[model samples]
Target: MNGAPQVQRRRGFIMGFGAGAVAALGVAALIAAIAGDFSGSNLTSQASQVIRDEYFKPVKSSVLNDASVNGIIRELRKRYDDRFSHYLNPHQLRQFESLTSGRFSGVGLTVTGVKRGLRVASVLPRTPAQGAGIKEGDLITAVDGRSLAGVPTEVATARIKGPPWTPIELRLVSGSGGATRNIRLKRASVAVPVAVGEIKRAGTSKVAYVSYATFSQGAHGELSSTLERLDRHGAQGLVLDLRGNGGGLLNEAVLSASLFLAKGQLVVSTDSRTMGHRDYDAIGNPLSQHPTVVLINHDTASAAEILASALEDHHLATIVGTRSFGKGTFQEVIHLAAGGALDLTVGQYFTANGISLANKGIKPDVRAVDDPKTPQDEALRRALAVLAEKMAVENR
Candidate 1:
């Protein structure tokens, strides 16, 4: 998990134990099951009493706002016991939806809460982010005059995504060069820019390139289709360019990696005390049987890590990149006593091979330092070099 609680590198948030683990309904039900009078409002009444007596009365904490209450519950659970909790507010709900399903109109960039304020982790090249002159070391202090200090990451995102062509101004404090400037960008669909291709050289070797510009729901379909086409095109070599990819859906990561793995191999799994342990696997033979390579950088994270780890674990491909954003943790989404939901960290994850690429990203067998203006990839070069060596030995 490169961004704990991130999946567009967005919807990636925190989760907690099961609903039963967090909810009073279970308490109410259990109480009623024993008392034999479990009913609607009565459950709520008893639930409130139980919660009030257990938490509020003890600490004299009186919170009504759903978001605040949820945050407190989560804080308590994470700090103290393993009790389950969640957060639900209008902005939080909207942000959650946008992260998971809401398409935004803006350049895809990863911003995080760091010691030096909000720092830009990486910028997808040639997108609005690059167009706006947004660099990797910029610090986002405010958006539209809203100081991002103490703001939830999701809330910061909702502000970032707006109507296309509508200028959004970002106030920043630079990380390096000690230069501060306001970066303005117009939001647009961060899809279509990413491309996947398979290259076949008669006298040389086959090549497959999956150029990722940003994370999108369409990314999985596109990547899968590209793999299919490469297989059809008789590709013997593969190259996955995650140079600018900011990451996406958690499940998709598993799906993409599974495509190149043997059947019955586990891909990913979650570890939450309340949320029953779950695991994923390759449903079928993923490879048309081609050697592969994955390219990543400081920007690659979350779902990206998931895919990279799977292929590497299975020895299906070699990972080549500078280093990856280390983010690993699972969040639970709980239905609120209100109407919305809660995004809280409930578990952590591991590759089927049992390696947790959480804080430590997948290390390349061959490391390559990315030179932005160079336009040539050293990772691909090393990957090609390795694949060639293997192919040469096979031919002999």
Candidate 2:
């Protein structure tokens, strides 16, 4: 279960500083910032002093180089209590870049952090994790025998991914107390599609079912193509399935929203302290004006939330299923001079109606609970019924 320790070992030299004292000073500064006089500049100055002078560990001049500085900044960001802010070293940065490219080598599982530990949020179909029976809500204790408990989701993800055809073992326990078991899975290159569509023959008309995996750079193009094909197949209505989607690029979200909205419609807007205010407008022709439904669940987040909120606010689609994951903040990746990068949450985004889906997610217009016993999709069935009723009324 042991890999390289998360914390790097101190190699030489002794610094004449007490780590306990410096950590206390940091806490004091944090308290002061909370109490008022909270300038980011002041916080940065205090942090610099603690790292340069107060840290208990010896500070080597050679280690003070860019790479070490980046590492220190990463630790500082964690202390800053901003969960969305992250510093990626060069290797981690490359790994991230690979994810956004729509292809990567991994066990095909997505995870998230919670109070208990790292939990498996979803597993992609036909992947190694799915084949090994990894289920949602399973608490992942360790990767390759190394305990991932208390580790950040990003770090855990890094540990799980590797070159294709490599084997990685995951030790996990059920949501409830159960036997701890390890499952070995071979990592494979996963080429994720942005969106996939199929026409379902429902009574007199066909219902277009489109499921989007992530809002990567190619999302808009994929969405457009799918919509076009569905329309050609005489799809009378649409079910935009976004369950378990964690979301991706902001621009892709806006573009996806544009597929249902008309030109000049505001897709999303942002309110920021550092970057000021900004708005995104739809510029493409809508695929159809027919009745549409958006399927969402608790795992649907970030860019996916943006699109759902926009469509719901505009009364363009009837949202069914459960509440969304409520992640409305957007991050900006700033490349450091040290070949690494910093992803900082710089702003909060709002729907077309100016509603912020931060901690409070968007409520579904039609709440449909999941029915495990039914062979049919409960949410999809409800959505199809709603669309059918709408179409009937329109014909009248």
Candidate 3:
């Protein structure tokens, strides 16, 4: 989710845009000029609402000389209820910038809020997070001097992140063994990779492992580059890992699925009042012919669900993992006045076959939950077996 929104591009969604704002004010103004009982409290509330909804910033006080108008705008703040209203001032804007860039001055690990606390979901490869040995499932207790019991996930992330070359301390409890560790790191500009590919033998079958960390700004380009490398490295069978990955961009999901499907094939479908489909048939695709198996878990959400559902519906790959995180709503960011932006869930996505997965997530054909400490690699093993059979049939 893009936490910060740009207010200029969303003129369609915000009603304050167009003459409607002025018109709304004009209606109030006309009434103010002729209405009876001008000193009544109810009229005062009504006038204040006019200033808040109709009046813009750096106002010409001479026009809205009514004190009631000013009070309505300031005291009531009813304009914020429009869903398009946003309050992202300069400070909020800066925080959003850091989140989108991916290259933040921090320990370089993506953490999420859970029942346990702020837990380290995945330690980005080759960053200070990895160097500090912050494993997946490590519940963070504190950062610097702040306690991490009730703060927002972003706030906790900001606590651990800072300007380049600054020091930050963290206390953690491991999910694997309940072991505790205290580590201090010098935050730097962490360069997160787009796609991660490793071609190795999985016990007995030769399955290629491809993990996507996040859908960052340049995700499509980065994923294409990674696929090229994997193709060169002799990846005939694929294990596309999507566990613990909260989705990034929407089109990136479509583009990533496009690489593995033929032209004119459906990738993902969207729902408005009616259903609509987005086709993925870009020319000169890379992995469209390869037999791929997607690895998913509970954390797979949004764009991840889109990609998984697309491939399964199109018969491109067999989804193998626990049930997905079940987030099927797509949000559209609308720019608001006052410099902030609004992110509203405007659409719902379906599989390529047009089966909506809004509240219900995509169910894997093969259910597997891989937990090493407890020793259950059910999903992975099933996927490996399927790929092994595929390879055997192809070789024969």
Candidate 4:
């Protein structure tokens, strides 16, 4: 009840229930036993009976024999229509934990599905993906001699990740070319860049431009330090770039908002049947009250949307660019006694104004589209223009 081992034992008992009667009683009878419809069919009794059953012998021999049980769990989620719910195997759980911790063993390319193949969105700095010259916009066609044409993006990404020092071959076509080339690279530990900033001239005045990659652990601390450095260097305004960001931890999202909002200001809230209603407020000191603009696009999601929505709702910053990705549901990672974890959708999140952002993303005040021919971010340029105008008005 208290530890993970206990939870695992409970899960094991549940699965082992009616093992002997499984062939005779079947799944329906098993459910009835669990529901207390049958006499002497309590959980413990049923579990003991199942464990002694001949069909359950393989389960006692190896975890691999639990495949049927795992399949059933997956089918249940599908029947419930919750695509966000996941039953991660041990290996996947390890990969996910690494990702959330800001480091993982992989080629270090952030990718999305495209018409032909998986498109390279961004290559992390100093990683194997970058080292192999896999720049943004490369379309991956195959992995390790396997053709990924028409394969799901999620499956392709899984094939790309593995233990460090392992070799992975990628066949890809350039974003602008017809020729396809194969690149062999060794996977290595890649750190996710959470926050980076620089000061840029906006209308003769210098404004800080900060790009937040994700809301990983300790993200607020990183962002606060970056902004503080910019403030010390005479930053007149700020451009918070949330383009291509896919969001991360929820608490980190609220913490990031705290950096710009007044103490105790409402950031977000959650609505659910089990958890009821919960509100999260900004707790830390305000970092910068300077005229600011937020840059967002279709890839900006979840926690990123939270920050954008909060800033816009509070009239704290001018939002620019396309609508956000609109991922407002929160997930709770429950570690199983087996080996992996369950990422279950817990609840839908709402902005301070009580608007649920589940399917309806945050719409920018000044919509700007990026040009396909140019490498420059047009949305960022528009944000700078908006910030410059605000700064000019404030000075006047």
Highest lDDT model number: 4
**For model 3, which pairs clash?**
6-335, 7-335, 7-336, 48-72, 52-73, 263-281, 368-379
Each candidate's clash count: 23, 3, 7, 1
The candidate, 2 or 3, that scores higher on TM-score is: 2
Best by TM-score: 2
Candidate 3 lDDT, 255-316, residue by residue in tens: 88777777667776666553354444433364636677888887788788888887788777
Task: List candidate 1 stretches off by more than 4 Å.
Answer: 1-88, 98-104, 108-127, 172-178, 192-195, 198-203, 212-218, 231-234, 244-246, 339-341, 373-380, 393-395
How many clashes (backbone atoms < 3 Å, residues ≥3 apart in a chain or on different chains) does model 1 have? 23
Q: Model 2, 1-396: lDDT tens per residue?
A: 023223332422222323566546645654564435335455555555446664788775434554455566567656754556666667767767765454548887766665445777667888888899777768788888888754545666777878899889888887445667888889998666668899985557787989888887778899889989999988988889888788888899988888888899999999889989999999877777778889888878899999898898888888998998888787888988857677777889988998888778879988886553445678778777777777777678
- Give me the displacement of residue 74 in model 1, in angstroms: 7.6
Candidate 3 Cα outliers beyond 4 Å, as residue runs: 1-90, 101-103, 113-117, 141-159, 171-173, 177-183, 202-207, 272-288, 372-382, 393-396
Clash pairs (backbone) in predicted model 4? 19-50
| Per-candidate local distance difference test | 0.66, 0.76, 0.66, 0.78
Q: Tell me the TM-score of model 4.
A: 0.74
Model 1 error, position 263 (Å): 1.5
State the lDDT of candidate 1 residue by residue for 139-187, as single tens digits: 8888877777655566666777776777788887765566677877787
Distance (Å) between predicted and true CA of 296, model 4?
Answer: 1.2
List TM-score per model, in order: 0.70, 0.77, 0.68, 0.74
lDDT against true structure, model 2: 0.76
